[model samples]
Target: MKDDDKAVYLGTDCGATTSKVGAVWGDGTVVSTKLLQRVTRSQDGPAAVVASWVDAASDFLSQHDLTWDQVHGAGLAIPGPYQRYGVLDKSPNLPDTFTGFDVHNAYAGALADRAGRPIPLVVGNDGNLGGVGEAQHVRGRGHGTVLLLAPGSGLGCAFVDERGLPLDGDTLAGMEGGHVPIPLHLLGAKPYPCGCGRTWGCVEVYTTLSGLPYLLEERLEKYPDHELAKSGKPMKERAFALRTLAQNGDPLALEIFDFQAKALGIHVAVMAMAVDPRYVVIGGGLMDPEATSDAFRERYLGVVRDTALPLLWPAQRTTLTIVPASLGDLSQSIGAALVALYRSRS
Candidate 1:
């Protein structure tokens, strides 16, 4: 699709941190240059989140002198795990009212009010949409299994089949990759307790922003004389300082950061081995280049390169490339737009 010839669809990625919007045309031209900080899922209700989206859309259209009718369709991507037909099953990061909420109907109502008719609305999991966008846009029409990992409040994984089709449709078995058990035996460390209330250990329990503090605090005995505890500050600030120190090659800080990197790398390696993806696209809060350094990046990639399986296990040989998400945080919006475009065609 060419930029001018493509359908003009609107997409909103309603993230816990921010909402990103974009316009995709039929001619393959994408103009994604706007963002709104999240105001939903606070002490307020889930309806507040839907209302905020409408308000943001109105503001965006007003600024550009674009009418609601100009939008061919609208897509909204929310964090998962989604229930049957685009309902949120349980979004731990959001308000409790959002659990099992009818996201599609909520969005349709909002758009109908603004446009005088319900603009076609499609909803999807943010990670799923992001992977779809990356595979379609950035990867340029290749055919192979691919994995998209977004390490934010929790670690999320989205896998696309070799045919370039995502596996969320009815009748397909669910793919909750993050909830899969982590092999702590490989790391020689005590298994970290998971929020899932399972002591068996899941990958997200140790790899996410929520998990970072616990990992660092557990290792605090090694750095009691370090600045974080000594200053009576919070763990996150200390983690940042430790990250800086690691960047500067301080021994203790380097050790802690390496543990995190290694843990993440191990999960990636396991995912790659399981899916045999040709490429792995990484995004989310932790993927911010500011939070990690090139050396740390290499440490994460190294685990994939050095990973080995048991002799009896069929060792899969495949070339896997690791790269940053092309859209960064904007992926969900772009993906949502893509989904709307797909639905409109159907």
Candidate 2:
């Protein structure tokens, strides 16, 4: 690829609550990362959100003392289920109006208005891009396969092939991982409510921001008269207290977190068996070191090891290596920038 054809490698990651941008150099190094507050989806529709993205892009370029003329192409990492190809069906944290918006056309239009020149733009699902970034630059580079889990507002998954390419064309790999059914019987509990409006158990219904509230509320009911649950404090505030208590080594807090961790392990182990990935990189907003501590990781692994299910563990040394993503919070942007850099070459 000619240097001129390489473009600026402008990339954008429009997430549930944050939007980020970054630039990838010709040598595959990601530099000049920036993140702005998420657009207000409640008050703004898809058009307004894209407009905000344009504004953010302009600011990013100005901050770096760069010009639109230097940009060769742009790439976007958006949330999953791009309606029917390069479009969004629905984003829980984004405006509902974006359900059918054409991503390629929208971005091309936005950049043209801002730069006064047309540039090729491509879009991808954030989960798949996260997997790509981690596979190529973080944990699984040169490995056979990798599984990426974004465990925050929801549990997102992406399977990357040996070439560090996402398995699905673009959007199919990451949107439905959270919807995998869970066996309430194995959990030894009542069927939990899922965010998908079902009473059956699913990963996201208990693992996401929405699910955290439900988990906390159930615990609150169990200890209604406890100090943390007293007075008119919000349920979420009390939940934070539970987190604090867990950090401080409270038994009750440990129990609650353990239950959740075990549930997560079940999901991870299933994916591991299905793909036998070389590495599993975990990310997401709530994947803070605080929420998922070493003890939690150990417990999660214990559950995976103790499963009686077939092929849960093999005699051979398993090649799968689980690790936390090293990209910090700017991974989406870096992934997006890489997408732009590569697609422009193609």
Candidate 3:
């Protein structure tokens, strides 16, 4: 493992349905043009899923004429919380088999076995990794604390502290901000069930990709003759298209996003009041240029700012910068890789 030898490490972002394998330099340069992807096969069980990802990563490296031993370090970004580095604590989104599945040493040992030697490969929750990746990305480095709001399948909130490390440590290990409670009235939302089994008040219930479906049902009840209800489209599909429809001036879509953005903005305010991070990074499919139109992005962000600004302290209200996430979908993957590299050096 020469720091100057230009070794390529691997980073894997494991999602519920798929896993992406990427090649990266220790300096954080992604070597693979297209990320190598594979179905997660979570239904096969945790052990099988873990081994498959490792094998897939191994093969991805081989395509670059590299092997595990030639790698500097590797990192895995898992979707759920865990402790002792790799053991899974809970996984509501994954199959029931994943609960309490101890990954403590088996995962690291398996990597060592594959490389035929001890190399630095680590695993961490995806939320924490997203903050880490942005902290190390060229555009985001040296920016002091970063508060990241990731609003995709679920709402993910993470922090990279002023020290250029994830905010997680022993006392706050496995912290997940998505489940933090927010006022439901922010969206005129009722106590809808969250994926975490909470009946109400979770920030995720109103501000994520999954949350839209619930919002749709509630919103449509009042507008029974609304175009969305009459279209006969699947709830999920309709919810996903909310941004597009809003951009095209669909009144119902605009109203729903207005509520969603306002709720999300309030969530951000509450978190910012606690962390006081210098940068607030908002990202995910809802606002990605590739996923939604700029018209929609502007409207959503404007609503967020309007809803949040007055809630902040006067000083932070002026100094805090809110910007879109720079790394987009690649944040967690690259962050995991950075985690490996940073931990190895530390």
- Listed in order, each prediction's TM-score against the native is 0.85, 0.84, 0.89
lDDT tens string, model 1, 82-138?
666768866656767888788889889988998898788888777777777777754
Better of 1 and 3 by TM-score: 3
For model 1, the stretches where C-alpha displacement exceeds 4 angstroms are 1-6, 33-36, 62-65, 162-164, 169-173, 234-253, 290-299, 303-318
Q: What is the C-alpha lDDT profile of model 3 across 232-308, one tens digit per residue?
A: 88898878777777778888888888888898889888998788878878877675677778788888889888888
Provide the lowest-lDDT 10-residue window in model 3.
Answer: 134-143
Output the TM-score of candidate 2.
0.84
Report the C-alpha displacement of residue 145, candidate 1, in angstroms: 3.1
RMSD values, in order shown: 3.4, 3.4, 2.5
Best by lDDT: 3
Model 3 lDDT, residue 58, Cα: 83
lDDT of each: 0.68, 0.67, 0.76
Residue-pair clashes per prediction, in order, are 8, 4, 0
